[model samples]
Target: MNKKNLRNFLFTNTFFIVLFLGILMVISLFISSNILFKNIYDSTIQNSVHSISELYNENMKYFEYFSSKYQDIVSEILDELYKNYINNIPFSSNLTIENFRKIGIFKNVDYYIINKNGIIIETSYDKDLGLNLANRVPNYWKKLNEELNKNNKYIEGISYEIKTNNPRIYGYLRMEDGNIFEIGILIDERAIPNFPKTVSSLNLNFIKSIYTYNISFIPYSFEFPLLDEEDKNIFNSLEISKGEIKTYTLRENSNGKESYVYIKWVPDKVNNKEFNFTVLTKISIDLSSIVILKNSIIFIFIVLIFFVIFSLALYLNYMTNRIEKPIMKLINNIESGKVDADAETNILEIDTLIKYYSHLVNTLVEKLKEEERDYLELKEKLQMIEKEKDLLYEMALKDDLTKLFNKKGSVQIIQKLVLNKESFSVIYLDIDNYNNILEKLGQNEANDAILSLVEIMKTIFRDRDFIFRVDENEFLILLRFVNLSIAQKILKRFVDALKKFNITSDKPYKISVSYGIIEYKGQNIEDLYNEARNKMEMMKMKKLELLKKLSDVNAEEN
Candidate 1:
């Protein structure tokens, strides 16, 4: 074939081949990304389903443990009451109730006792103390009593919204002497203290409902719904089989977000009465998170793929330039008026290079500008973040009144010191009779006195140490590298400094200060403050007692 025909055939074939390959690469990339995403989604779904199931099981375990412990507490309290005042009529007296309240059992538990005739004889809770149980007794109580009478065993079961109209789990123990006394413990739904803290950290947005049913599958409460209509119909159509985990898809009416309802059956035997309890946990994906993650991954993948392709194209262009180096040199020579000298040589390569160079150069220049703009925007964002951090530090740490480090600043410094295991002492001081001074000398004089105290405290404490006004009359001094002995010596010096704290007012009163010192030992800030406050209160109380005794002695002398 002639050189012109051959060149045309090669160029057309190469262009078609590259176009087909690009299309195939794009489709393959998309298909692979989608498959990978689906796999990740499926794995996450499986993990979430397993985790939620475990959470449900753990919740049941907690309920069981709570029931057993609650039963033991109730039984112990009843036994104590029976042993101490069974024959005594004063069991119904105020003194007995007061004593029970003081013992901490009544404070922590809600309990009521019923006699053999199903009458509420006594209750730890004040509201139900004198209430009759005849009308208010739940059907569960009757079932419990029947079991107690027949089997002579303890009855325990979970119920919902009975008399108090709230979910509760009850455990009853029959006394030994056929007294038929029953103890009922009310479960607090507000605080599921036994529930695992880890579950709360999962950030699950769902409600769990658990219900107990008899062997006949008749639910006693509305805590959990029965299986859906279709599932119920299927269940009824088939012979009753053993319990199983069932999942149903629940579709939203508005936005069509997918949700799942999971139900598991737990067979329980309480008081010889077989019961099938169903636990229903409803879980839904955070649609926002799902959308955000999906879009973000896709966006990132596309950007990355485009970057790879663009980079590859640039590299291919450089390679093409190397391969077309002779053509480029010939074109440059022709442009410089030297092409006629090489006109006898091959001109096909030079012709093709001239055809594409103008378009390629324009595209590369625009790409460079876009990249530079993105880089500048990123740098501006970093600078803004640094400025915000500085602003936050100034606002949080500086005190408005004295323009010094405030309580927050002191806390930050102290936390760092404690975390680094550095030795320190905290001297908590309160202006004695500051409130009285405010009342007697007025607000203006009190303000001046406070300013004077702050000035004196700043001068006495080291610049490295922190001084903060914690309250209207109380201040804290954080002294670094100080032991208890040094803290006490510093406290003595602080007391002497208080004598010099004077406001230049017409009605100037002497400023007296009381301080409590605590050497830091890696204790929590709250605990340190509490210890210091307790000591300060004791010291103030002793000073008052001494003054009272002196007054008594003066009266005797008179």
Candidate 2:
């Protein structure tokens, strides 16, 4: 409605947008920080889980290296037992548990003979007698059955005695009678030469260095120092879901720090690719520092971001003030009839707004041109009436015979256009040998010839062009909006038309013309007319010289 109202409306919308963008930026920053820190926490926890899983694999290497030496003895004992069973020898008569211990390789080994029903029917240790292994540990029973399905293949698993809780390295082999031959070697019997202790200590140090607060190892239900089928399922499920044997979950810790529990599946790593089972490994990590950093980032960025937005809001209002005044003034000026075409505002908005109402501006300009046209028409009518009065009285404005303008009227018309800086061209024409035509033909025919020439000139030129008989046989033509080359073409058209007329004329002599044309070049009409006369004289001299050359050529031919 008004400049003030318009500016206030723009300011209100601009402020609302700035406030909306500012709030949006703060929210996005906080959300981005939270997501970034959460990813960092998850990545750290996964790393810790990998490191501890690798440590477990490294410790198992020591157990494998030490236990392998005893593994050869158990294999040799199984070869002897399989041979006896093949020869149809009864195990009850030939090989008692005491008799088997008498062999040098079997003395340190405690062997259990598990029948097809998974019951330990025979054993070197009395405590393992009549034990149902399938019921107590079904996971281990399944592993023992897999070993029995193969020919002399064995797997080593560390298990504690069921009743006594003594640690043992157990290996399983299948008998020829579909029974499992299970053997155990005491950990005290096979020593790792301090390597396992060093590895264990290193693992503890590495875990402490990684910021793991507490770790618990639970596989399915109870903690067992065994890699079983359940752990492999967890490993396979994680591998399928995550493309690796690792997964993690987030939780709040008791001490108000953020915690992540990472579950990783570690393979038995026996032959690199063949895994009998996998261990379900869990690692707990803290992210207190990461949380603090995220909080600080949110706080500091909010303050800095809000400060930046406040400055922008002020700058927007300032720029609005700079833009409003020019546009209002331009709009008011455009509504009026006067326009300053050379006015300076140095603002693109004002110039653009002026052009925006182009229809109204164009209508105003056309109305002014219509008024000027009417005034010009009235002035031309008055000049015509004044010329008629002069023609009737002294024959000074229009030539008495041809009725075209004479020198006095022609001078006034051309000088007026020249002072107005209009573009035009002038052609000066001289009728060749007009006096001879007048002497040979009578006065009436000569006048009729001049009148015919005038009519020809009138027909060739536009109504806007002026034709003047300035001298007795010389005429001048003023052609507006015509350049020098265009006037020359017009002269050529008139010459061709005259040549056709002469061919068909009944007169005794032909009418020929000498012409010269020049364009106005910021000169007064008098100087321009004189220059045309000089061009006409040059044309006549050129014609005379051409005639003399033809006469000399004819005399030479004679």
Candidate 3:
């Protein structure tokens, strides 16, 4: 409330209010503009996908038409070759190479005719004429017969020449009387230029057989010049099946350009024989439209925000000066060692804030004093509740008489060990004659004897070992990091100690424990416990047999 201090506070507070308003306005405009830009981008991608789908459908129609026409022409040529056959002449010799050459079917194909004897009786290649094809290719006729038997007259597959290992597409016909007329065409990618139909970014491939239907094994494939190395890579990776259309993005390439690719697979059957073809298309994308629109909208929005903020700031500065003048006078009076009556303002909110701030100061002082007294009282109550909770938990988990973990607690610990895959052994111990002791010394004395046995086990076993009173007369011990021999050694020491340990009861009693221990590998706790119990029953049987023998010897001596 000094003159210099008041002036600095007034200027700093006014500057911060202006800065905060400006930031809020800018953020509001930015968020709205970003949401609008995202909507425009999503709409663009959806439109592009629609357009590309229409283009793909149109191109596939042309490919299907041309393939069907090619198959029809081949069938006609085969009929013409058979028309010259006579009943008296051998079937293969009736259709000579000259007849096939004249029919225009062999213009781009090497023609041959093979008889049932598996000999090429007529061939366009003079060297192959009269060659025993069955001897040369034992499985060739077998495969042809298999296809023909399935009612497929026209079959196409990859075949190689007997003399030269050159590959060719062997499209053949299976005539009656077991005579085969075959046409082998060397694949030329440019031979069927119209199959691709000169569409930009469109590539076509004609696969001869069903087995070579994918890009990796295509017999004939052609790529348009518009498809770059990146597009080719995307095409190669495609795994389209028959009648499938797929779309995916191609990432940064050698030139760091990205694009989208679409592929389709078409399959057709001609005269009961199947053929497959695949089409791949790619298109480049540009973000110029979205970027330009976003930038222009953001610029105009920001200008509008600036105008609104500027008008608001001017009006607020005028009001701030008017309101703070009275506040400054009130502070000065207080600093000059005078008690203020009140601060008044015409604005209702500002008047209310001043009134409430004074009331809040007095209320907070009283509340602090009240809270201190309540906190001390709550602290004592919380300590007592925590102690009670601890006692309840211990009672739930521990046996009342022996203070060993009960069945529920022991099972929980075993489940944790199994989950952790820790190596341990379970030793099941049973009291040999607990019922006899109970009959002789009553319930309380028998209970004391059992407690003494638990104490003896505590002294004999390590602290880490978990001891449990899991049954009425059974005590289970889980020994960690101990093998069968180590567990046996510990149990032996427990029995020896129990023989001499005194049970604090009205009558003296000697305790004996029969134990069965099994080292755990990976079995469930139930299975391991059952196995240990079985071993303890066996030990009990052996001890009974020894006692019977001793009794008989004493009888004979008497």
Candidate 4:
């Protein structure tokens, strides 16, 4: 399977149209030549058969007239004799043969009165008087009898008598007296008329002129005229079947000369028997006279056909390119993924199609842009919503003032550590005397101290460690993947950092915090937190007792 694009296909087929036309012209010429030759062959056969049929009909008509006229004459004479003489005359009265002879019934013919036994009892020719029809011409009489039996009327046909060797048209009438009255007329050379030989000669000349050949009519079982052994062989090769009416034409090669031979069978009658003859014609075309003329005509016709086809091809190319150029441009636009150009055409349907296509492309472009814009806008909206949600989540987890994780955040971290069974420690820290400081200074100063403490704690701890404000005055830190020593170190560092940090207040007093530490190893979060808070309360109480001891010593010294 060869693949071709539209432009290549159009250009290639434009030239092929000329080739197609040439083939068609050749086929038509062949068919027309065959038809013309067939007509000539058919006409020749028809004329030959027609002439023979006409001659046969003329002979039959003459025979019918001769036999019917004499039969009526004999019937009337017999009827008159039976009515006036044979019927009224006495039985002793004799109806002599001279009576029939005198009436001229036997003047140029033979007459016989045959009895039921086919015995000829009376005859105009005395020599045939004692001959029986059965012994002499039995089949002929039997045929006659069969014909007569059909209609019981007079019947006649041409037959020959075996004894006399006389070819005669014989008619017989069976009379009421149980006798058959028969009449026979000798058939001479003029009996069957011959068609004019000049007509045959003229027909031969006509056939020669048209077919450029020679013809010969050969009677069946007769010697052919001066044919060579090869010619005889050629004729013998054409085996004409019996009873075939249609003429046959064959192509023959004789002495290296190609010829067309036509054979036809012509039937004729001899003594009531049908026989066939053949008319064979061998036609060899002499192309010398018409060859130049035929070639010239063919050349002119071919040139004309080529010129017409060439012009048509040119017009087709023009039209195909006209349509293809615009379509190609439109295809290019589609393939390039953009519609920056449009196609123009003069043809109305093409123009309409281009316009509709251009509109469709433009609409599709606009729709695609709209879809992209909508997608981008939706993406932006989703991003903005995601950012707002993140801010809200941060606000929910962190304290508003210190921006540290609240009690809920502390619980979340502790639950995560417990679920993971992490090795970590929780250190619960509280600002000591935070209520006293809030009463002494202002709420704003107290909040500033807490924020100041949160910054100090962030500096002492690593980012991985969790630090979150649990309440107003309390905070918790989770150190992950650490032991008791790491927890103590982290708590001591936080306490030391708090001692040096001063509060930003009018009094400018330092803030102190109590710390409680415990190692966390997948412990219940609530129980671990409560135990650490209890330890912080015990530390606070020990510090207060030591401060009271210092105060009593100072009072004694004063």
Candidate 5:
């Protein structure tokens, strides 16, 4: 064909090729972008969850610690009430309240005492006195009473709605002398209020403020007005379980435009039953700006790749046209059994092709007298040389023993696959006790065994799959677009094949192989390889243990 025909053929066949490549490029870009975005999202969520959990935990610890110290103070107060009032003759109720008030003077907490019948006999806060505590006793107290009845000490995290606009945590102690006394400590919510704000401030200079709520589901303190109508609805709708983290969104106004609000729930302790406490923090990401930036990047890359490919195609078409035209004219003349006396071309390739055609036509005339033997021999020799060149190229990139691709070839193929961003699986295989086998059987038998193994591998693996010898005793197999189950099936087949082979020399032995297979989904290649290698090592160790047991059994029998 002439150069024009050649160009036309390529353009026709590769029309789908270019279109397919373009679609692939777009898909690859989208997948890469999605992976990067997911990584960012996961990392953000992880860090936020960790920080909020830590803050809630520390806050709970502080509250528990403070409540314990307050318990000691309550013990002293109860002892005084028993010694100075209850045990003394003609017990004065007024003296108890007055002494309790005196005891509260040095303490930083609000305190209250209830009688055996659940009456608020005395309280440090004046507004609480004479209130019937029977109706207000927290559920935790009832549970605690059950425990105490069974002769167990009662220690619990309890929550109750106090008279103030806030809730309070109380530590209660039932005295041995039949009077029940409770010590109420208004948990200082503000002690760790700034924690979420501190974390929100990190890498988020864009966030204006942060808010934190207690386990009571009350917005105790916040750096900003945390609950808008929608946010409140979301919070109310949350069905949080213990130690579970949930995320929600909110909307806010910033710079006279609407912004996003993010809230996350984190538990203080896994076993905590009373309160599903969470630390809620919010930030506004400029979604419109991010969309615009992402679109701009995609547009730029598409334009760049399109222009480069288009230019290269044009250049190749031009060179092909220069070579094809003269060659086609010479071929037509030879087919008519006449020389093209007027044929001439400025291009060197075109001129050479024409001269070759003329010589071939002259040879054909002579071959008619010699039965075309010389021409057939010359063609056969040319084919052999081409085959040898191809063999050399393959040999340069392959392992001699396994006849599989070497390290360099494996890396090259993997890099190309990565660029395509297609899903694939990698299986790393190590022959268990390969060195010991070599030592027992010697090098000659070991080589025969390896060659036989290569034959088995070629039969098991598909033409599309890439098998490589990565180390002395390890083979790495790359399976494209395959899932874990398919990779495992192939590995099982390989193991089965090895089991069928029995190579014997000085010592008869069965081949043993251990493999680790990993199905990747846009994970880092090196990390995936390391994970697979670790699994392979674990498998190898198990096999070695089994082998050792077998050996011990044989020795005992002998």
Candidate 6:
């Protein structure tokens, strides 16, 4: 080879080898340091999270105990209050509720008179007005009904008001007419000093440990005080986008202080199983010493590697020991300050696979959510169509004037009953003096009388029984699972209610009703209905004849 060409080739090869070797060493060291830091950081966070969870569990015990005690005292007080009032007042058709209403207005006292159907027939508070508890809270309502059958003294723990969500103490008692009397009072009215008021945040100082910790109670809806209004709003929106998260701890850095931020839930097991509250605990642990030790070890290794690079031909073994010795010592924790581990080549590979898999899983989750949204939208549309169909069906069945079932609805009900072959009785009533009343009081007053009669029938009959206005001043009632005797008893009750209405009313004339009942015993519905109507006609004739006799006797006496 020529001298000039040989010299140029050697120089080019040596330059490349040195440059590439230096780059490889720097990269290897950098990767190793990062791996070491991650392991130590992960370990420290895991230990802090465990400690925070333990402390939070210990803290909830005190709150639970106080909650039980508070409920006990309130239950006893409300129990006695209900006992005294229910016994003294009693239930009556003519009972004046004005005094009770006045008391309800002044005090935060709520009272409900519920019928056998679990409907609130009358209530002091608007929240309970017309409420059907049987459909809403069946278990609790069933328990109340059971108690009514037994001792009629049922008291329960604290619960939120249905509409207000304000805590209330409640009790129930049995009343006449198969009705239930329920009473509720605001909890604040009964609360005394030293009552456990829900707090937002607390700064507790541990005198023995010389540690000051900040524990904050998080409401379902909350705002952090440290953030400005605009930033707070942005963060809250982001939090919502992240969805609801609970019962976890993670490392957080704020205002130069490092801490384990814990989110926990404390349930009110003693009072209500469905009730629970959230707490956020931040425990700061000093990590400065660990950081310092880790940095110092890293610095020593970095210096040793450079020394190895400069003296590789002569003192390679010596430089390698220098680098290895310090790392080996650091592998053992420094006064429990620093955590270390042997670097793994697979750490980076595993992390990359995890990120790629997470992206795929997230994409799948979004697709599933979109499918769920479509399902819900379709379900809502179907429900709306179903509701519209129901409304149209109801309009067809209901009477225009009195809001009772008409002829068409009555025919449907009878045909169904006959098809099923269930025992039932038909009762027909005709207003004997409907024409006379129309002539005397005009059409409006006559309509008022008919409405009054309908109300009386409704008050007397069970809700399960059906009442139909067949024609003007002519009404029909169909009672299922009832014999002719039961139908007669119901008619008697209607007479009693009508009598009360006439006595209390300020109308110009008294109201009267005539009824005829026939039990269906495998007979034609037309024949039975005709028989009931004929019987009513006969009763009307007999009354007219008696009136004529009375008139003649009065004429003779005069």
- Candidate with top TM-score is 5
**lDDT, candidates in the order shown:** 0.59, 0.66, 0.63, 0.62, 0.62, 0.61
Candidate 4 colliding pairs: none
Q: Where does model 1 exceed 4 Å of error?
A: 1-9, 59-61, 70-152, 157-184, 189-201, 204-258, 264-277, 289-558
Per-residue lDDT of 1-558 in model 2, one digit per residue for the tens? 535576777677888888898999999998899789767765666666565556656555555554565566556655555466558665542344355554332324466788988899987678879998788667657866775566466746443345543345566777667787776655442343222123223343114222211012233222223344543454335431121434544445685355534354433545432223233343435467667777888999999988988888888889888887777777677666446667754446556877877978899899999999999999999999999886575566888888778999898888788778789999999987788889988787778788778877877888989999998899999889889898888888788778877898786778878888999988767788889998998998888899999999999999
Over 4 Å off in model 3, which ranges? 1-359, 368-393, 500-507
lDDT of 5 by residue, 65-109 (tens): 544544555556445544443454444445544555643423234
Point out the higher-scoring one by lDDT: 1 or 5. 5
For lDDT, candidate 1 versus 3, the one ahead is 3
**Candidate 4 wrongly placed segments (more than 4 Å):** 1-358, 502-507, 555-558
Error of 1 at 93 (Å): 14
Report how far off residue 41 is in candidate 3 (Å): 67
User: TM-scores of all models?
Assistant: 0.35, 0.40, 0.35, 0.36, 0.44, 0.35
Query: lDDT per residue, candidate 6, 213-304, as tens digits?
Result: 11122221223233235432332232210112333444445632244433333333432422222233333444555556666776777677
Q: Which RMSD values do the candidates have, in order?
A: 18.3, 42.0, 24.4, 56.9, 17.4, 28.4
Please give the lDDT score at residue 305 for candidate 6: 64
TM-score (C-alpha) between model 1 and the true structure: 0.35
